[model samples]
Structure formats: structure tokens, C-alpha cells
Target: MGNQQSIKIFLALMLSTAYIFSFSHFGALAYNTLFKNTDAFAAGTAIGHLDISEKTAAEAERLLEEEVEKWKAKTKITFSYKEKKAEADTALYEFYIEETLRTLKQGQKNLAAVDVDQEVLEEMIYRTSISLGTVEIDTKKLAADLLIGATMLDESGYTFHLENYIPEAVRKSETISKATVNAEGSLNEIKALLKKMGTVEIPAKAQFSFLRLVEEKDIQMHHSSALSIMGTAIYQAILPTNFSIIERYISNALPSYAKLGYEAKVDEKKQMDLVFSNLNDSAYSLQLSLKGNKLEAILKGQPFLNKYSIVKKDEQSFTPKTVKQYNARLESGETQVIESGKTGLLVKMVRKIFGESGELMKTEIISEDFYAPVHKVVVHSPVEPVQVTEQAETGAEEGEEEEQETPDSTTDENVPMPVPGAHSESEDGTEVDEEDNEGDEKGTEPQTSDNTGQGTDMPAGEEK
Candidate 1:
């Protein structure tokens, strides 16, 4: 019995020694894993597609950067519209590398239960867990950049669609309005302005200003020469002559649309402007262009209203007055006419909106415009007197001497004296004139006899 008891105690001591040795071994391994080799990852670790196992943290970071670069190189984004296309690289985006590294460290800290084995623990301690940082794209910036590229493409004769904005089919359109004007002067600037307007989409019930449509400031800034040339040409010329190609187009066009109760006009100073409501439920796009001598503003969209007619009333004209001035330089009874005048005008533009059944829906007075008149002028001159000659004085003195020597006529005391150029009946039945008996004479006035009744009187040898 004693021997058996001793054997049991020895066995107990052996078992206790075995347990102590095993516990010490495990404690040492745990300590090594927690402090000695801190630059490793736990089991089951990965970053993106890279399996960064058994690598130091620094080494893992390098590998992650290389992988991210490769991914970015392969990433490509493309935008297409009609025949235009634009591309961008993902490398341009911002990345969060440090944040990803911190995430990886946190993930490693939350690792699952680990079995302590010297060989296994040593292997896991060398493994690295990594999380490649995320890449974020700046959408606004991307869109802005894309727009610049697209504009260049468009200017090069390519059609680029706006991001996320595509045009739909045209459901309805018509010759809702039209304007005509005699085209004169350089149309270059007007055409350029229309081209800049290009194609624009307008929302429903929205108002579009012609000035806004052309982007007046941009043109003034970029194409100042064109604007200045056009403005000067229009301003210096006369009424119809001064009207710009754009002004004439708007003036003529507005009336047609105005007949439909759409507001349109060229102001008194002839600044062109058009204000109109879309009226339709759907959006509309307006395109302006110059075709030959015609300038057109076309609206494209679904129609919501009926067709109508414009009733233009009589055009009343003001008569111009003529002014006359006397000029001494001009000959007597002569007059010079200058400057034919033009009459003013006033027209009442009225529009009658009609339904499909020809029923009048509304009447609108679109405009009451006034045109000024020009006056005419005339100049006249006065007349001068006639002059006398030397031969006439000698003839008058001879006639007076002969008349004093001649005897006085006597038949009956009551008989009247015969006047010069007077006809008297002789003994014959033939008629005779006293002036016809005399030689050719130049005097034109009638001659009178003196109180002695001798002959026709001559005053100071002056010719009649």
C-alpha cells in the first residue's frame, strides 16, 4: 500500500510539471505575437485584388500604391453625343490612401479568435492586412471640363450633346410668324450674332428676350468690332436705310407673331427685342438663321393653340409742306426747287386670334407706331428793267421839227385831229393809216400832238 501511494504522488507531480511547461510556452508565444513582431497582419487579410499576405506594413503600402496606379491607368470614362465624343482618365480623381490604411489597421484589430501555435503565430505575424484607399470623382468639375471640350468639338463642326440633356422629337411646328425687310449694308455682324444664338431650349411658359438670346455682353467682349460696325451703320443711315438687318428682321417678324398676341417690337430707337411666352405645355427650342435676304426666327415645339389671322387696318399718312425762299442771284420769274418731302405715317396693328372654326377668340392691339415727315423747299429770283439806244434820240428830234413846219389840218372846226397810226377815209373808198405812210420806226409807244396841233409831241428827244 505504501509503494502504491508514493507512485501516485510522483505521477501527480509529473502531470503538474507538464502543465506548467505547456502554460509557459503558450504565454511566451502570446507575448511575442503582441509586442516583438508588431508589423504584421492577422489571418484572412486582403486589400482589393492584392493579396498582401506575409509582408511588412511598409511593403504592403508600396504594393497597394502600385495596384491603385495600375487600376487607374485602366479606368476610362467616355461621353458621347451625336458625332462628338470626349474621354477622361480616372487618375485625375482624388484618392484616400491614408484613410484606407487606418481602416486596414482597425480591421486587423478586430480579428477572430487565434489558436496559439509557435509556427502558425510566427507566419501570421509576418502577414499584412491592407485596404486600398477609395477614389472619388468630382462630378461638377468633370462636367465643366467635358463642356469645354465639347464646345471646341462643336465649333469644329461636330454636334455635342449636353450632359444628361438630349433633344426629343419635334411634335409640332409652323410658320407662326414671319418678317421681311429690304436687306442693305454689311450683313456680316448680323449673321454672326444669329450664329452665336445657335440652338437654345426654353422651358414652358418662359419668356425669352432677344438681347438675352444673343448674349450681348459676350459678343461685345469677344466680337466688339462686328457689333460696333453694325451699330454705326444702322444709326447713321436714314429711316429704312438706317434700319439694321437685325432690326428690320425683328420689326417685320414681331408683327406676325404680334397678331397672335405675342409681344414683339423694335423700340422707338430701333433696339430689337422680342418677349413671348412659351404657352405650350412642353419645352421648346428656338433657332435663328439668315437665309439669303431673309432673317428667320423659328420655334420648334408642340402647338397648344389654334391658328389665327392678323387684320391690319388702314395706314394713315401725314402730308409734308413745301417752303419757298426768294433768291437775288436767280433770273426774274425763275424758281429753284429742292428736297422732295416725305409724309409721316401712323399704323394701328391689330391681331385677331381665331379658333379652328374661324370664331374670333380675342382681339389685341399690338402696336401704334408713328413715323416723322420731311418738308420740301423752293427758291425764287426777281426781274430787271430794259435799256434805251442812241438812234432813237435823233429820230425823235427830226420828227418834232417836221411836225412844227407842217400845216394844221382844216376841213370843219368840229373835226377831230387824226392820231398817229389812226385810219382815215380818203376821197377813195380805200382805208389808209397815217403811221403806215412813215418809214420803218423802232418806237413802240403811242405819240401825242402838242396844244398847237402841229404834230405828235416829243419829250426831251426821248424815244417812246
Candidate 2:
């Protein structure tokens, strides 16, 4: 009898162990399933985190019914859910789902009329499901996890790759929006969604080119005989395009090429520095350092520029010598072959000033004939003194007599005066200015004059 009891006890222990193992396995599977189902529901129905009142939940359901009827829609399946309660450990919800379908003969009458297109049925199903909220998802962890996963997968998995490849294009393309999912059910339901997102091609054979330069003044100030750079770039697949060479040089360029990036400095030299990178089928970088009056260009970390061929082209004034002419091929009945004038801040001002007058000049070609005489400009500049003097004499100086009788006033030097052509620097050392000076010369300080206190010695045919 003791032996028998011992065997029974052993058997009981084995059964208990198996039961616990089985329960654990089931629990794990259920946990995973909850997330999977929520994901499917999210993809199929667009009912997202909803802050709905008891009244709104009912109203949404009613609205769905009305919308379905408006489409003259006949459905075999219809369902909805609502948030019964919001709880921390558990989420309570109520749901209702039903389907009715019938295959009717040409002459036979069917009670459950659901003979419809698959797409239409799918859409109706999705819309109806979207009307329900927390009624579908009860568990908090499951709901939260599914949302987090979907977001991660969508952003990292779906978008990251595309963005790395063709950033601008991919961002502009259409993707699976929440509203689209809610209305259409699934990604497959919307046939054109993926196609609309588009594709980017990376070419195997691509070439990248970049330009770099340093002024002669910079080289003289730094006391460097010459300037140079050296580096490397690679592409596994397609090449990069019009990259911001000046922007990404420090962060992306040097690291890609495995080169030591130095914070370049000029101790006694007055200089300018720039760095930028670009990638297309290939990657390219540009580094420019100016010292004294000399300029140098650096590629990677080695100099790849013709230092002897360095040129300084002023933006404010076009070089008539460098202007290239193309042979004009005239077409039959094509009489007008007007050449366009160069664009600049001053050009627009000329347009506005001339436009105000009845005799507007033809802006196609800007020559000496197109402008007013230089004396006219001088007249306008010295108008302030003449205007003030005339006003003082013409007006009945009532305030002047009262002030003379009572007291005197003094000028305040503390008042702020406008600093002409100056720019303010931000926290990051970026300069900001509102005046459009795209084609203006740099470092041209105002000069003192014989008569006037100070005036800019404007470049011939250029504006101040």
C-alpha cells in the first residue's frame, strides 16, 4: 500500500509540472496574438486612440449607418464597438459584429441581399469597424504595444530606407494614411497607394564633381606657401546628387572618407573658410580657405585645384570680357531676338523707378541710354539739407519762437543710429540681413569724402 501511494504521488507531480508548462506556453502565445490582432485591426480599421463620450460613440455608429445608406450600400456584414470604461490594468469595451449574405437566382427573391463587389464590401466593412473604438481592444499592454510597433515599423522600416535613398521624393509621395486605412480597410484594398509612393533608382556607374577655391589674400595672411586637401568618397549602389557641400562637410564627409577633420584656424591672417559635401552616383566635397589675399581649394584632404588659374569674379558687376556669345539660329517669321539684361538688386530698382514714369524703358538690354544722367542721382542724394532749409524758412516758426522764449533743447547722442550695410550675428554665429545684396561686392567699406562726411565709393554702374 505504501509503494502504491508513492507511485500515485509521483504521477501527480508530473501532471502538475506539465500543466504549468502548458499554461505558460498558452500565456505567451496569447500575449503575442493580442499584439498581432491589434495590428491587423489597425491596418484593417482606422479607429485609432479615441476620446469619445458615450453619446459620441452612439452618434458615430448612427453616422456610419446613415453613410452606408447614402451609398445605396447593401452589406452582409456590419459591426461596431465602443469604450465602456478606461482602466489601467484592463480596458473594458463592448462590440457587435454580424453578417448576412444570400446567393439569389435571376428570378428568386433573397431576404439577406449581399451580392456586391469585393472592394465595395471591404470598404463598407472597414468604415463600419472604424466607427468602433476601445470596444475592440480590451488589454492596455496589447493596445499600447501594437501602436508602438506599428509606429516603429512604419517610421524605421518603411520610411528610413526610402528616405536614405531619395529623401525629397519619398517625403512628397503618398503613403498609407490613417484616414485611408479607416475608410479602405487594408493596404491591398487601396491599389494605387504603394505605386503612388514611387521608387528611387541607384545607378551603378555615377560620377560626382565638386569645386573649391581659396582667395590669394588668405594665403598671404596665413604665411602658407600653398593650400591643398585630400579625401575619398564611395557609393555602394547609386550616386548622390546636389548635396549641401557647405553644410554636411564636417559631420558626413570626413567620416565617410576616414580622414581627420581639423578645426582650421588663422592666427594673424584675415580669412574666410567654407566646407560642404554632396552625393549622387558619387560623393564629392569642397573645402575653401582664404588667407591674406590668397585662396586655396581642398578635396578630401588634398589640393585638386589649378592654383595658377584662380580667378575673382565680382557678383555686383558682370565682366563683359568673360561674356560668351552663342550663334542665333533664326526661325521663319521669328522677328524678335531681344537679349535679356543681367539681374541684380539695382536692376529691379531701375525697373520700379522707370515704371513709375510714363516713358518706360525697354528692359531687354541695359545700356547707358537706359539710365538717367549721373547728375540726377547726385541731386537726389543732397536733397535732405535743401529740403530742411526750405521747410524752416517757409513755415511760420511758432514752435521756434516759443522755445526761444521759454527754454532750449539739446541733441541726444544716445539715440540709436542706423548702421548701413551691417549684419547682426546670431548665437550660432550666423549673420542675418534683410536687404537683398545677392550680387553685391564684399568688404567694400564706405569712404570719407571732401564734402560729405562719408559715402560709399560705388563701383562704376553699381549701386551702394
Candidate 3:
């Protein structure tokens, strides 16, 4: 009995010693991981448990540097961070960290830093016996949580100047490509668009321009959809001589809105048309035609608005009075005569009487295929004939004509001012064209010519 008791006591003593040794070893290992070797240096104690790692502090500088590099590459700004330190438990983790970061990147573009003074206190409990090896820690979740609080700055750190982001090239391309002006549009339409842009308050304002150069050799601009072709009218800045080339140039620059189920077409003079319809039905078909000095717009059925018409007499002029007069004539079922200096237009209205509705709508100006002399008569002849003569004489004199200065060329700058919307001011803030300022001495009788004012059924606004 004595021997057995002695044996039991010895065994108990050995077990207690083993437990103490193991606990000491485990505590030392846990201490090392928590205080000296963790990423993000997360050294914080929660409840009675102190979760800490020295590895976090060691990697703090490297993490900051990495973040700085990332921001530099992605944006136009750059940043840097400085190393900061704090003890456990009593230290302020967020304030200290933020302060340290702020000092490191002071006045450095958009970079800001925060100092996190961490306060960690560790408490441990262990059995009195047994030998202990290193304790394996599960750091995956902890590391992720710590990383949430850390940030870095880099090379491309700078103040944001939003205006600079839009390059001059892009602005130029957008301005020309997505012009708001429509061809042969009415003054009302032009005014409406400009008003939408708040031009009434700030007249010179422009909307955001969107332009994209496509890889395809040719690009088609559809107004609504591709299923059918339509009309597109544009009010553009064009010289009389450039009428032919301008058409082709515009066709290439603009995009088709046809994917949305409409096509655009440019009409004679400076009008644009957009047509919308489905393959099976003409019943719900509609045409949107734009015209006038301010590029006003109108809509009509396939062949409904063809007979009665109000057309522009000149390519480079915007006459609001003329447009209003045209509208009035169409309403009264009267034949109106529009005389602009020497340009004479005889507008005949074809009244429509639908059912018992007394006088139905007269006509909608679908496309104005009208061209007339700039002056009713020049001292000797019409404007076109005179231009033809000038060309012929120039062809004959070729080299000699290049050196000769005609009276027309010398006093061209002395012409009277032009009406608004009809002509813009020249560089010297003056209207400088005599052809627009014809007098009684130029011609008395109106020139005779075949008017192309007759409306034709053009395919909806599909640009060819």
C-alpha cells in the first residue's frame, strides 16, 4: 500500500511539470505572432483575449508603399506614407494612425493619412503541467479584417481639375460632329433648340459635344432605325459654292440614328428630314422635316404635305418674316408673293378638305426644293448668269485674272449690314456683302426661272 501511493504522487508531479513547460512554450509562440509578425500590425485585445501579431507592424511600411504605387498608376496623382508606431492598450489606434498618415502626405494632392495608435494587452491561462510546442494560429480572417483599416498612396496623386480631363481635340471633334443645327430648318426650330440650351440667357453657350471616329471606312447615320430609310435635315454653315461637297462631308461626319428605327435625309438647300415607319404599315408613318433661318422643323405624312409649300429663296440667309408669312398664306388658303429684294416667290396653297371639317390643314413643308436669284435682276442680268460669265471670263484670262482686281472685289467690304439670322458679323463686326444689298438701280423686273419648290415624296430621313 505504501509503494502504490508513492508511485501515484511521483506520476502526478511529472504531469504537472510537463503541463507548465508546454504552456510556457505556447504562450511565447502566441506572443511572437500577435506582437511581432502580423500583416496590418493588428494588435488589439478584445474582452479578456489580446489578439496581436508583430508581423502586422513589420509589414505596415510595405503596405503603404504598395498602395501609393497603385494610386499613381490608376490616376494622375501620386502619394507617399511614413512609418508610425504605437504601444498596446493605452494607445489610440485610429487617431494616431491618421495623424501619422496626414503628416506624411500633407499638401500632396488628394492623399490623406491617419495614425492608428494601437493599445493591446494580452492575458493568458495555462495548466500547471505538460511540455508545449508552438501554437498554430488561424490568421486568414484576422488579416482580412485588419486590411480594411489600412490605405496607401502612390505616384499619380494630384488635385483633380475636372475641366482638364476633357482634351481640346475631343472638344473640337465633338463640336463639329454633333452640331445641333439642322439643314433647311425653320427659325422656330432653331430658336427652340437654342432655347433648350439656355441660349436665351447666355447666347454663346454650347452643349456637350460627342464625337467618335469609327474604324469602318464608311459610316451611315440613321435617325430612328435601319429597317427603313428616312430623311434628315440640317442647318449648317455652308457657302453657295460648297453645296455639292458639303453634302458628302456632312454624310460622313454624322452618325445614323436608324438603329432606333429611323433614317435621315438632307434635302435641297439646307433642310434635313428624318422618316420613321415599319415595313408593313404606312398608316402610322411620319416624316420630320427641318428648315428655316433658325432651322425650324415640321412633320407630315408621306404625300400629304407635298402640294402646299413654303421654301427658302437663298442658301445663306435666314428670314423669319418670310417663314411667318408662308405659314399665314398656307392657313388662309391664299396665294402669297414673297419678295426679298430681287428674289420673288409665288407660294400657292393646296387646301385639303377632309370629311365635314370645313377646311382641313392645308400643307406641311416637307422639303423645300427652292432656288431663286439672289437679286431679281442685276444691272444687266440675273445672279447665276453673271456668275457664269465671271467664270467664263476667268477661264479665258486664267493667269491674267489672278492678278486683276475687279471693282466688285475692292468695295465688297463696304456693303450695308444684313438682317439678323440672315448673316453673321464679319471679323470687323460688320456685314460685308453687296449682293445682299441690291437697290432699284440693279433691276426692276423679276427674273424668270423654273421653281423647284414642288414637293416630292422623299424616302424617310435615310442619308444616302
lDDT of 2 by residue, 1-464 (tens): 99999999999999999999999999888987775333221122221121112223244345333433432322121122111111111011111212211121222221221222334323433343332221232233333332332221122211111112223332232211110001112223122321332221212223222112223112222231111111112110101112222211111111211222221111123222223333222222333333233222333311111111111122243221111111123232222212223321111111111211233323221111111111100001101121245445545464453212321111111112225433322223233342322232322322233321112233355543
- Specify the poorest-scoring 10-residue window by lDDT in model 2: 375-384
Instruction: Score residue 145 of candidate 2 by CA lDDT.
Output: 34
Q: Residue-wise lDDT of candidate 1 within 1-464, one digit each (tens)? A: 99999999999999999999998999899988888768776654666445556566787678766766665565444543211244533433344555555567423321111122333322222221111011122334434443442211121222222223322432335433434332334367667665565665667545545446446436442433333333222221111110111222112112221321122232322333333344334465545556675444554554423444555565566675554333456675676664465564445445566553457767755434334444444544433233344556677877753232232232112123333323332222233343442231222221112221111112233321
Off by over 4 Å in 1: 1-175, 200-202, 221-276, 329-334, 382-464
RMSD to the native, candidate 1?
A: 31.8
lDDT of 1 at 25: 100
Best by TM-score: 1
Output the lDDT of residue 375, model 1. 45
Best by lDDT: 1
Off by over 4 Å in 3: 30-40, 43-58, 73-233, 237-464
Query: Judged by lDDT against the true structure, how good is candidate 3?
Result: 0.27
lDDT (C-alpha) at residue 4 in model 2: 100
